[model samples]
Target: MMIHRLGTMLLLIGIGALPAQSQVAPLAPSDITNIPPDPALKNWSVRTVQIPMRDGVKLNTIVILPRGIKNAPIIFARTPYGAEKALTGAPSNDFRLALPTSYADLAAAGYIVVVQDVRGRYGSEGDYIINRPLVGPLNDTKVDHSTDAYDSIDWMVKNIAETNGKVGTIGVSYGGLTTLYSIVNPHPALRAAVPINPLVDGWMGDDWFHNGAYRQSFLDWVYRMSADKSSKYALQFDRQDVYESWLKAGSVSDMAKQLGVDTMPMFRKLVDHPAYDEFWQLQALDKRLGKEPLKVPTLHVHSLWDQEDIYGAPAAYAAMEPKDRGNDENYMIIGPWRHGQGMVADGSKLGAITFNGNSASWYRQKVLIPFFDRNLKGSADPGIAPVTAFETGANEWRRYDRWPMSCASGCPSRSKPIYLSSGGGLGWTSPTGAGGFSEYVSDPARPVTYRQRPILGTYNPLTTWGQWLVDDQRFAEARPDVVTFVSEVLTDEVRLAGQPIAKFFASTSGTDSDWVVKLIDVYPAEYAEAPEMGGYELAISMDILRGRYRESFSKPAPIPANQVLPYEIKLPNVSHRFLKGHRIMVQIQSSWFPLYDRNPQKFVPNIFTAQKSDYQKATQRIWTSARYPSRIELPVMP
Candidate 1:
């Protein structure tokens, strides 16, 4: 039975004979290829090929055969991540093995699948360069990602004689990034592609940088642990706390001794460059920002709560000019998930919330298999109206032709701002009567700690993926050590799409003070239910914004403690159908722990080097009004 994929249905409706139900068979790893496979699909052979790249670097690749046939349609996945069967392919239904998935999924579907390890990591050859060194005055010898992807495709096209020549790429995370990178190059053989949770763009500003201010709670450092190599520095230092731990554990001398000369150079360099600089130039992947818009069809599957690359995915997708976003060639799917894996960011249990199903299953059944079935097999696959996303709070899937907004004729005339009045609530008018701005003393010595603790497999000390974002204001609520801001109840549903920006006008008594803004959807009642196991949501959903690069990310300077400084940070992209009976809420604070590190009240050269004595609590003031109202601006869709 064939499913009416996105294309076939569009074709049928074009010819007019359409009252049909979609046919879909949820695929399982066991259903992949049986050494002989079930006679249903067809026969295929396997071949091993070595692909060479620029400068003579070679990558080991595997080609899946189709019924011993020659020159058939080929599907490609160029990945630096290995394609080891036991580790890479699909696992048992119970996931008794590693990841229950593999290249077999594609091969079994009747398409010839080609898999390769990226240069330097697995079987591929070449010196790994996470921070590609500046060899010449301007260029770096280390082969960049673009050249790598381009070279791999060239090899597949010329050497892989049986491949009908057409190739489509797919992968998650690193592979996803490569897929996105591949299309930018305009390769003739590469036509259709899927970049699942691709690390598309923005290293600093996304989750790691958070508008120039680093997300302490995010474990960007530990990832250094698994970079191109497991070297002395990579092993000795936990990227998450090298700066802070070195200062606290008094391990500088030991660290310097352990990392010696060769290792610590790069880690130390990053600390010094704090803001976006030349160091991030060759290292960041988003450099391909405006590369020629795709000439072929594409499917970009990204996760919303993904700890690693959410910022890049949506930012890159939304950044496309209208001209570049034409046709079904480019489709975007974002699930409430963390990093490159899983669909729902939440396992459905946030302190008290729980979602029953795993997003991967749905993604496999509804999106993955069906998508390929339509494009490759020319089968009848369902249109895009099916599995767009499950509104976590509402418990349902909503579909639209495009993301961000649903057909914006012109920013809705109904746009309005809900002001933050006195008494910690929102209203239409500026609560001048609520008096002046509230203040908090930020102390570096006894700095308010970020509540997140270390988890088992967490490489970064402050990785806050899969945590709670509730009203935990009791500790900092009236404390002089924290800043607070609140908005009034909304009279109507502020349907929103796109990203939110939290702008703050603040002054600190110390050289530096961390500022965070959160946009909350205040629900109607304490709608707590055993079925909705995830705590309370009369509080709805929330997102945060940090302040450090208020002026710019490249430079850092103290605010002289009390002088006011205005800063704005970009929050994550969101799609919420805030109902009419709900209220729009926003909160501002200086600290959000284990998820982020504590900001010692003092303005020191580095956050990690500050001492307990330097943690003197300083006063913080927030300014608001129609003129500079510290606000949360969202993309309101119809």
Candidate 2:
């Protein structure tokens, strides 16, 4: 059972979180008998070392090289999955590991690769604190993996031989985040870097919540896995039969029984800290990394379909690269796959669709390799475009000087912010004068979580976790329970980039209620596009919130029953371009199932303390008037 839990969590992290090949074995020095180097690899060596951190933790790492060598100049990838394991993979992420042949091949070309386990986890010594640790009000220690990262690289440069006194780093997801954090200290010897789909912040608002609402499923699965490290609930956890039973039973609302029995303490802690308050502010890379100017050339990689840590990658790109510096140097890529899945596809996998039929080889040969080569090998710039996005249906790469419409750089006509009228229409003519208001009754009994399974075998599990993929507002629209305001079909193209903020000037009948802002690209009434790969039409969507944890993330306050509360939540950013004849849809509802924990409508010390009887069905109001305008503020191409 414990193995099942670990296995389940492993699935969440899986190939998506870790790099690939086969999981490497931890062996003693006697086992270091060198295997003959593949002909392709002539210059590097495989060496093992213990990197000592300030806190007396000796982290383990492996240096992979081209031949029998000393410091061939290092490119590091630090992971929580263990140093040797960093380069390996689970059965699924198998192919991503550079084969002995590929390594030999790259080595023949020349570049040393080093991998390490972070401060804890795997063979490392310190306690693994999951992510960039929290030095919040509860615990005020101005220390984290950031400091440890700095210290280790500081040590590696001086001691390692082949290193001409410099290092470059790269990785996808977790490793990618490590790369960004490692470079922030800007080791004197560090040259260049790349971070793909990195987890941006620990703020419940970002990683685990979409607008004050708790994002479940993926978070639930991950937390449970992290808690036990073994699978006590493996059978019931993975079995679809048991899934329904658990679903019928309850979601995390009954965490003690339905799923995570041991994770409540931490879960409550996360729920308690809902906003980007001091707790999240401290752990977030945004705050920490910003304090220092990013001087290195970085390639921000993201998957268009990426569901995990999707919010962070793009934001980091916008951040590290100075907007003032307009150059091809700070590049970005968004592919057709999710969670970096398509990045290493041979095709047979990826739900029911086989990416193998249509794989992007350029990623391996032209992009990633060339990147490591250019930086570590000190080769000239490869002339790759600044922005390369894979157009889904086209399954082809499109290059641009910047994200969104390149030509619209200085265009003024396209920049416009449409408003959501109370009655459900969009634009200036949507009627704001006479009685601009609407209501919805939120019932906690039928709380909406994600419709798909939590782990694999589920569709769009990361971002769509806890929420159903086919969240057609049609059902909610029919229910007097959901308030949806949509824009008219655009006559021309309008591209929105950067984060979009939704300002809700309204009130709620309940002491605590959640307002979910979902930005969706609504298909035409009679239009339907065939599924690009999974036979499911792509529904590009992202959301954010307003809830009980309004002004204070750490502290909680009720809505005062019938009083109005002005709320605003910065929805996830979108690089979407609304073309001719398409309508922009904004869905505001108080409920999203299992993907988010059900919000108990009554005001109590904590929702956790509320009884089932306290779960009341409360009314919500949307006041759309000139005085209290509730609208989405989008960043135009400019």
TM-score of each: 0.75, 0.75
After TM-score superposition, what is the CA distance of residue 489 in candidate 2 from its true location, in Å?
A: 4.5
lDDT of 1 by residue, 1-638 (tens): 25658678778777675344544556775855538544454344456666877789887777765555565556777665565442343333222222234444555455677777666656667765443322333344746666676777778778777766777778777677777667766478776777777665434554445544455433334344344443223344444544444335322223334444224444455346666666555545545444456565666676655655666666555544243544455566766555655422223433343445655556655776667666655568557542165455554456655665453243432334555543465555654443456666554434443332222223434434444343333344445555544444455555655666665567777777677665665455544444342212322333333345556566666666567666766676665666555556665666554344556656667754445565566677776654556555566655
- Weakest ten-residue segment in model 2 by summed lDDT: 530-539
| Cα misplacement distance, residue 448 of candidate 1 (Å) | 4.7
- Give residue 406's lDDT in candidate 1 (0 to 100): 57
Count of clashing residue pairs in every prediction:
62, 39
lDDT of each: 0.55, 0.60
Please report the TM-score between candidate 1 and the true structure: 0.75
Task: Give, for candidate 1, the lowest lDDT window spanning 10 residues.
Answer: 91-100
Candidate 2 residue-wise lDDT, 1-638, digit = tens:
99999998889977676665666767766956688546553322457888887767788888775545554666677876556653444322122244332333344445566778776556667665656553455445655655666777788788777666667777667777787777665777677777877777645434565545566544444553356433223313445433444345544545544555434455656656655567666766755655667676777787654566666766677665564275755777775556655345442234432333444455656676677667766778787777666543324455666654462233432434567787687674424465477777777775443333332323323333322332444444445676778777778666655457777766777778877776666555554442432212223445645466778766667778777667877665455566565677776778766555567777766554346677778888887876667777776653
Query: How many Å off is the CA of 278 in candidate 1?
Result: 4.1
**Global Cα lDDT for candidate 2:** 0.60
